[model samples]
Target: MNVPADDITGAPAELSVAEVRTAFQAWLHAKASELGEFRNLSTDVDEIFKSLSRLQRLLYSEGWIRLGWPEEVGGLGGPLVLRAVISEELAAAGYPPPFSFGTQEVLGPAVARFATPELAAEVLPRLLRGDETWCQGFSEPGAGSDLAALRLRAVDDGDTWRLSGEKIWTSWAQYADRCVILARTGSLESAHKGITAMLLDMDTPGIEVRPLRSMNGDDEFCSLYFEDVVVPKSRTLGEAGEGWAVAMFVLSCERGAAAWQRQAWMRWRLGSLAADASDLPPHTAGEALELIHILRLMSRRTVRSLSAGEQVGAVSSFDKLMMSTAEKFLFDTVLSAIPETLLLTDNESARDWRSDYFYSRASSIYGGAAEIQRNIIAERVLGMPKD
Candidate 1:
């Protein structure tokens, strides 16, 4: 797709974060009536996805979402922090982010950094425009938190490689058009050193997606089964046997940039909880707000560091750990403040509350468990001895 015309919104190619935020907030206000519909969305995951996809398209057309992306890859060309402002301002305005927001931050960076320029130019725009959704196929049945132990195998076949493995807890794989998957191409004893990251089309033969129902009653997570699936050698990310670096980069984004998005959403939820819970104690609400603020500060630092091409390394573990802590605290406090609404009410708002509460229970477990985060900090950050 061609870059958005200058006359569309007349935004400069390079904009400061404040300018981007002011312009975006102005657009949101001017289009409030048009954007109001997204303030309240369906509880059904598929319906929510469909609705947000439209929102993403609208943002793309307006050029807000294109800011901070390179012109070579369908972006308007600015610092990445400009893109972060879009999601923050959207949530602050009571709008849900596009369905692919998390994937865009988590996987998009890795692909941009490691994929061939031709591949990045071809696919990144589709992802940014919400024309396609992607999933991360890192966590296997044997390697949820211990990602280095993944047993997925990818055997070389000259022009292509054959992948056979099972990936569990893959979020929204059922709706993905493509997936970035990690497979072992070396000896089992090689651990992380043997891994290779490859991008694959989800429609490829020998792939099966089974949606697993979460406690929220939404099939948000899925099991991806690949039986000798063929992937071109060209799709390999970085050099073979060097996937560990790619994986680390992806994890850093997942734990950092994605956390930025999550904290924004959490702050929105905190505001709603404060409004709904008439009897909520001031102290309880204050504490939750404090945790959320701490998360925002930490996540912002990480996002900016990433925008400047700095490696955050093990420091991102703190962001992941605090994110889960703040999320669980906010939802737990919400449960305490309005037990009846979350437990017995059948309305849309109540269902959202119930769903959020249930999903929050997994906050400590998903995306590298809290315990694992602590271990990383102890060993890598604090320089403490491992067990």
Candidate 2:
């Protein structure tokens, strides 16, 4: 229902989450015609990025995007829950998420907390307004799940740091304006302790980005090579030997807020799945709904914790686990109910289904693999034995 309130001016400083949602919903309703063309999904990545950037700029100008961020970083100052609502409401309205959502959720908060004031003030606003995009550079050739084993090295160079290493599985690096990188500054023996996180501009010399294609056949991820890349000391997110903490924080958001957004998109996809798959069995649909509902509930709690400024920590593993299983289950249902359309048809919709199906298979692998999440749950959350 609409709030019956005046147009939202993006300065609802004291509004509660429900109030914010009401006003935002009303605004969306009022601006329906203006945002109509943005309602559809784009097949091209460049198109998607460009369209999302435009959307971000619109939201920023309308003040809607600034509701939950600090004024120092181009926001109007409100609870972070307001930010989460913006994502949920957009997805509920059939808009694919802004490409900035993942990076903003995963990396923005870390920089806000850890970067120097000057850096945060300069970079966060660009990120929020979609003026720039950022990527997380955590995993290396040998480090994915076990991030402590990462070997990307950063050497101190007085005013700057000289970085030399490779980072793989970096999402959207080709389009990123900057990267939140974790590199080792001490001996390998120090492992996680010797690492530090840096906020580096993507255009820096000696940095190469090579996009890689997965089974979905999209180059959504890339390999980043750093050859003596010079990074200002001011770009450091946290002190030396503190990247593990920074990494943990980013992962928390990845599994928490990103999962929250994923569930929203998945809910929309579930509805679309039902509409497309008339032959989909009732039990299968019921099962899928229930799984998605569980993810929504788990993610909601994590979001609340985050909005309240609580560190969600390892509890995010539960959400990640649920998210992966639920994704695979949903797409598996698509494949089963529409095998010919999903596998043999040549239309755009068919190709989309095929791509989604393959991408869903990797859901358990990214954001901490299924096996590793189980270990975290068993030993960390459940307090069970390590083995």
Candidate 3:
């Protein structure tokens, strides 16, 4: 609870994921008296986000969030899996991660790997501390599955690059401070090779964010418009034409490592259902439990692969596919077994179930669509010939 301040000049000791988890759990128990009670507060999405942000900042300030990051980036330095373990423990304990946690997993790695050391040192700490939020700018109206077809254009200027295009289904863009944007920097004929990645400030002139409502009754996704937005050369990620690699790296993290966190949350939801659903049909509970078990097994392998710095590559498609199947299956079970609670109850517990069930539909859509993951698994992982 009383983490020492960052040692600017001194080398910090590295801690393994297990050690960090044990320390964090011990700290959580020690601070249990001061920590706020976990509430289901599911109705107000903004309020829930605010509360989660505050929680992340608290953990960040105490140095827990910095454990797995590099000392140069304000972390104590350890295997990145340490952070993953922390997230799993938190979610298993019934604490929803701070809304920005996904950003750390999805975007943080790419930046840390490709960004200038100065940039990584300057920006990543802020992200860890919840002082800033970042969003991916990959999917476009026509580029959802065919990302190589994205039309966003970024032309190099002497001092800054000019960007113009639209990105759709960008989550939390309205609340994000920075975005890892992909744009066409070469000819349309170049396909993925011509694309480039850039880190742009959300407040840049000529940029707009329009929130889109989901079936869950929340504005969690947004459509972003970039009209000749100027981005500094320093904002570029990797080489001018290496955006595709950066994008692939980000997607791999999303599909592979991020799935671990989701599995942990799913397992927690399964336990909650078992505890609360008194009238649940036996078969329904059994099916949900089976799905959770499958997801946990698949995600555990993916997490270990990622933690070991393995390429994972097309193999991650299997993990993504299983995760989507498991998520939808578990939530469908919830809806069927607890229809009254999901549809009619107005309490926070019921609202959480309803909202989660609605959001579960997107599980197959985000990261990559279920169809796309299957296609990858068939063509790449299994080496099956494309039809």
Candidate 4:
């Protein structure tokens, strides 16, 4: 796990997605032996994260992971789709993405867009290099999917804000180096209008992280407590009382670009499921393929639109809804096909299947519940009435 520090000097300033993909494939082939250690990572979540960080370091050293970001933030300067291409290629090669991949797509863009230039330049490189990890601080007690209902309060304190509240269902908060949190800056009645987004170092005083173990037997989620945590005004993501825009933008990336990454990983998992199940039913496999392909198309459109600086708006709700549907169906089909692997066996592959099966049950809940997505599509996208 000893990765040498690398100066980002030789990376290309520009490259098409196709060019990036081709070169990346070639690199993977040439580095197959060196990358073999990542093929079978340890079951311990901490170990898995450590090994994945090494893989990320390798990719960053070679400039694959940094390809579409701004050079000012440690990138090679290409269309954002270039990074997507690299991620998909990694999955195709049976490699797991760096743990920071999701955060990079979800919170990284918001930081780059809404944060001050100095902040973006200072923090984004650490994210790109996997030198740091971040977690989103959106969901809270009684505000899981209804983000506007969150009650985390940010009180004015002259040059800083004092934060006090609890945030639930924060993914990997215990290991995070930073967090993008939303707090109420106005009256409770103001709801979304009074919200404001801010960036905070996870190690700040008066902050506590309590890990929550999921059914998958992993401490993947956490509950964060901020008791009079002081944050500088310079850390505000956007203007005070304008955090709704930041929240919306972050959620858009979560549902849009993050969906793209998830679908890629799911597609790879589908292939793994097929190879492991010797007697896998043809119809089930076909059905799974169709579901994954549909998600692929939807996610691809969203990724392209986002790369082009286009606002996908409520339509991304379809991608979010379909992603969960496809994921649940895919994993459910896995459990149904190989009940023994998931429920009876104790080997590594079996453990993987077992973990994924249990985790899939939550697909309908995280990143905005499936019901929330449906409601968004119905009321916002289709002009349906909420009665």
**For each candidate, what is the lDDT?**
0.89, 0.89, 0.83, 0.88
RMSD of 1: 2.7
Q: Between candidates 1 and 4, which one is better according to lDDT?
A: 1
**Candidate 1 — number of clashing residue pairs?**
0
Predicted candidate 3 versus true structure: per-residue lDDT over 260-317, tens digit per residue: 8888899899889988888778887787778778777776777777667787688778
Superposed model 4: Cα runs more than 4 Å off: 1-14
> What digit string (tens of lDDT, one per residue) describes model 1 on residues 107-140?
9989999999999999999999999999989998
Per-residue lDDT of 340 in model 4: 83
Evaluated against the true structure, the overall lDDT of model 1 is 0.89
- Candidates sorted by lDDT, best first: 1, 2, 4, 3
Name the runs in model 3 displaced over 4 angstroms. Answer: 1-16
In model 3, which range of ten residues has the least summed lDDT?
3-12
Tens-place lDDT digits, model 2, residues 237-263: 888789889999998988998899999
Model 3: number of clashes? 0
Alpha-carbon shift of residue 59 in model 1 (angstroms): 0.4
Compare the candidates by lDDT and give the number of the best one.
1
How do the predictions measure up, each by TM-score? 0.97, 0.96, 0.94, 0.96
Over 296-368, each residue of candidate 4 has an lDDT whose tens digit, in order, gives 8988998999899999899888888888889889998998899988899999989988998888889889888
